[model samples]
Target: MFPDTPVTSAALSVATRFCSPALLNHCVRSYLWGVMYGGAHGIAFDDELFCVAALLHDIGLTDAFDSHRLPFEDAGGRLAWVFAVAAGWPQERAARAHEIIVLHMRDDVPAADDPEAHLLQVATSWEVVGRHAEEFPARARADVLTRYPRLGFGAEFLGCFEDQARRKPDSAAAASVRRNVAGKIAANPLETHQG
Candidate 1:
């Protein structure tokens, strides 16, 4: 359930312009999954911030935003920070959003302090790697997938990561791609046909 606020709309527009259809769908599904996970965990977070973070999390993977030197996650976080500042969000809120985006790739997000970051981390993990999928209700998963079909997101995203790795061998994505490309690709839930 994406909000219809101006900020949310702006983030979606930016994502749509830069991200492929499959990646954009993944972003939307990431938000839905984050919200669902937060609700299930009884965590109270800023839904709007979470929405923006989810929509823009993988933005650096887009050609327009990709930084050959910076890790894709870091590039995305920096881009989000600029976007939030440009959108008239307060400096502190923008900084928080930046932190959330940057830390989403971590194995353990510091959720004890920032529940929003934790939700985004787990939500992305669930969408990308199929982690904690069973914890959510089956109907909710089906509804989300039905609303935003994967559309071959797994292959598309893998290709994006591979390209990023090729361009920036020292970047975090490159390191990840180097470590286990096949395993990562295999773990992608979107790669499987869900009906």
Candidate 2:
């Protein structure tokens, strides 16, 4: 479940249609990691709200990937906007989240100014690079490297994500997910798959 925020049912419906359960769950876990990292590093965000934001951040992936687009940055933002409205998130909040999601994939986005924004970027990057890197068709990887070199914390964030994923939501399924992701990234060409 997400935080007690007002998001439109229509938006939520669209989100459900767009994202697979596995990817959605992965985003949720990534958001959880961001919350943990914030506490560990003395950074704080509206954890509940951000968790909600991160959960729906990449709802656009279905369309982007379906269309066979080489780059996901712009598409991710557009997807966020579509779901933000459908889910009933406040206009301003959704807008901000959209911008952050778009910039989240880019290395040039000024990450130093806002901690929450930075957390979103860090969390999303970690989840993708760690769990989905190799599985992520080569074109997507190439797109990421070419379009978002500055927001390039993929390796470091994956390490942090794997460490965090090992804990929380104790269950065989959770552990399996962690192990699977760790294994995928471990042998990946990206950052030596250090996690």
Model 2: residues >4 Å from true position, as ranges? 8-14, 63-70, 86-90, 108-112, 130-184, 188-195
- Each prediction's TM-score against the native? 0.92, 0.54
Lowest summed lDDT across 10 adjacent residues in model 1 is found at 186-195
For residues 1-195, could you state the per-residue lDDT of candidate 1 as single tens digits? 578788889999999999999999999988988888888878889999999999999998888998878888899999999999899899888887788888887667756788888998888877766777676666777788889998888778778878988888877677768778658667755457342
**lDDT string, candidate 2, 128-185, tens digits:** 5453333344554454444333233334434434433444334222343455655654
Pairs of residues at least 3 apart in sequence or in different chains that clash in candidate 2? 6-88, 7-87, 7-88, 7-89, 8-87, 8-88, 11-86, 11-87, 107-150, 107-151
The clash numbers for all candidates, in the given order, read 0, 10
lDDT (CA) for every model shown? 0.83, 0.52
The top-ranked prediction according to lDDT is: 1
After superposition on all CA atoms, what RMSD does each candidate show versus the true structure? 1.8, 14.2
Instruction: Identify the runs in model 1 with alpha carbons over 4 angstroms from their true place.
Output: none
